[model samples]
Target: MAMGVHGRRGRGGRRAPMAEINVTPLVDVMLVLLIIFMVTAPLLATGVPVDLPQSRAAPLDQQAKPTQVSLDAQGRIFIDDAPVAEAALPQRLADLAAAPAPPEGRRVYLRADRSLDYGRVMRVMGELNRAGLNHVALVSTGEDQP
Candidate 1:
């Protein structure tokens, strides 16, 4: 630093404490933080990682936290993140129906891989319907496919 009166001067020509603040470093740090968040934001979404079909339809007006059913490319089934065998899905869904008031709404979101067999997806839907869970919706990515 230069040994000169760069700040407010006192009567003896000695520089007083700088009352002004330097914001350059503050802005630099803030920009770095922004970039970090921008880089990491997309990585925070956790899910079954199925390639959802693209749709132009409007999003569902969700009334409650729906049950999540997922089907992978290999035809494995999942209920709310728990693996369920194909044969057990119907009975499992029926048991879920016998629960108290909340599960009665039976808002189910069916997420299947885009490459999944259409018949397989239909079979799951059929089971959900048979179990009195008619309020089912197929989950799909928006118009843009990643």
Candidate 2:
């Protein structure tokens, strides 16, 4: 009498190694990374906390990394999230302008708290202009954005 096990081996009675790659694990890993980044992306936008004003204007198209100048509700000034004295702001802006710039010039994003005095914000803008950093964009939240 002869007996054979069903679906366990080929005609040669030997198991064949799988040649196909299993992509389920790879897909699972990629999905996990995507979720992690999606959750963390907004938090990384800016280090300083400010109650930005709302505007109906659309967001600007950004081609390069621009310098960030922020003014908080307390009237504190920050350059790229680092605190800067008002007296030193002009010098710092001058130094930034002296650095290598793109053909369109170094772009600066000015973020001021909505509660700040208009004159204070203008003073910072004046400093930026005096330092030859003319390409300034006011950063504001969209009307529908939180």
Top TM-score model = 2
Q: Which stretches of candidate 1 lie above 4 Å from their native place?
A: 1-52
On residues 16-127, what C-alpha lDDT tens digit does candidate 2 reach at each position? 7778999999999999999999999988886666555767777778788899999999999999999999999999999999999987678999999888999999999999
lDDT of 1 at 134: 84
User: Using alpha carbons, what is the TM-score of model 2?
Assistant: 0.60
The estimated TM-scores of all candidates read 0.58, 0.60
Candidate 1 per-residue lDDT, tens place, 110-134, comes to 9998888889899999998899888
- Candidate 2 ranges beyond 4 A from true positions: 1-52, 144-146
